[model samples]
Target: MNLYSAVSKSPHRSGTCGPNYLQRLLRLDSPGTQTILSGPESKAMTHYLRSQHDVIIVGVGTAVADNPALNCRIEGVGLKGQPRPLIIDPSGRWEVESEKGLAECVRLAEEGVGKGPWVFTSLAAPKRNQKWSQALDKVGGAYISIPSSDIDGKKDLDWSKILEKLAQLGMSSVMIEGGGSVINTLLQEKYLHLIDSVMITIAPVWLGQGGVVISPPRRADASGQAIPAARLHQTKWQQFGDDVVMCGRIKQ
Candidate 1:
């Protein structure tokens, strides 16, 4: 499991901006702060990430909330082959609503690339949104599930089973991105093997009730005390313009 975070930032703000006059102004360092990752750097990072991971995983909240197109073939970073797209939709709700959800499946089919637009849900089969299932089926994609009971006590969802299924479809590695709860669950269950971060330092803008960037939940023993610390291997960082990309491996 190779986890990665892909973020773009400007000194004026902390995320990417669309092409416009204002965006050009924001990129200038007149105010003593600079955007990290020039347009070229961002394109390179996207290409690198797509090449590195066979599968990319994100939570339902991310799928629904951000409605990200989540594909690798953006303008400058042409995806050589499609990487598998995986979504952890425990409740089976996101498939029906998200435009990003629909686009991810459709684009893969249109491009005729990669293994799947896979959905990892608690449901054993696809539901009422048969249109979504049909779209995926047309592209040789699938919806997979294991018993939710298996995940009950920080027991780890049967990631091995999930990996086996992906292997059958030819995926060799996975990149897990998140919307906090899923990140917390994966960390607590010790399911992650590596982590990558595209660190963004912003202009202190606050969204008082927004989701947390990282939330590694603690597991408690029977007496309710936190479990002992797990060893973290080491972290490596690379400069992407003024921002940093940090990667860490979890020790076995």
Candidate 2:
């Protein structure tokens, strides 16, 4: 299975990191981004990427914050080409009954325009929230429960198990678009190798320190020497209107 992740971010002037404020900003009908960012082109690239992948995965945080449609909107790509939407909600915290995003997923599925979501939750989550499972079942969606493992004493989903589940569903490729923590966790030393490639869209504006940032987890050697920054091989950059898209594979 090939696992790929894509993100769009704006960096601060001081080289600090920030969130996808550009995306959020563009989502609003506010004045400001008209001349600076090419919103349509950037979004088209994202949808095109979605059309190319078999599944799209997002953490519950993103599923909440963005309320994304999670479907490929490119012209003429019918239901069969639509990537499967998957959410990694370890505790089944996502409220599918009220979440407009998953609601849209259900709508798309029923209308034959896209597929419903496949939510991954902890084994215990179903027992805790039978309503969540029931809601998914009502929409012909899946409520998959996998065992959780301890990471730093906190429960975390195992990516390997999740990938195996996706594989069982016949999905060969996955594209991860996210909220900060999910991206950061996958880039950590423990799971970094699972990623086959990464594509990032760099927006022109600086979002400063007040926003969420996507960064690889930092670690040190046994002697306390800091490890080098993560690197990508075959890195390539292309302009998507005002934003620059960088594509590369992990340098493992």
Q: Which digits, one per residue and each the tens of the lDDT, describe model 2 over residues 95-158?
A: 7767333466666776778887888988777454566566667656788887787777888898
The whole-model C-alpha lDDT of candidate 1 against the native structure comes to: 0.48
Best model number under TM-score: 2
TM-score of each: 0.64, 0.82
List per-prediction Cα lDDT, in the order shown.
Answer: 0.48, 0.65
Model 1, position 227, has a per-residue lDDT of 75
Question: Residue 233 in model 2: shift from native, Å?
Answer: 1.6
lDDT value, residue 20 of candidate 2: 28
Error of 2 at 229 (Å): 4.7
Candidate 2 overall lDDT versus native? 0.65
**Most accurate candidate by lDDT:** 2
Kindly list the per-residue Cα lDDT of model 1 for residues 113-215, writing each as its tens digit.
4445677776453454778777777766666774453555533345445555555655555555444555556555555433333222122233233224444
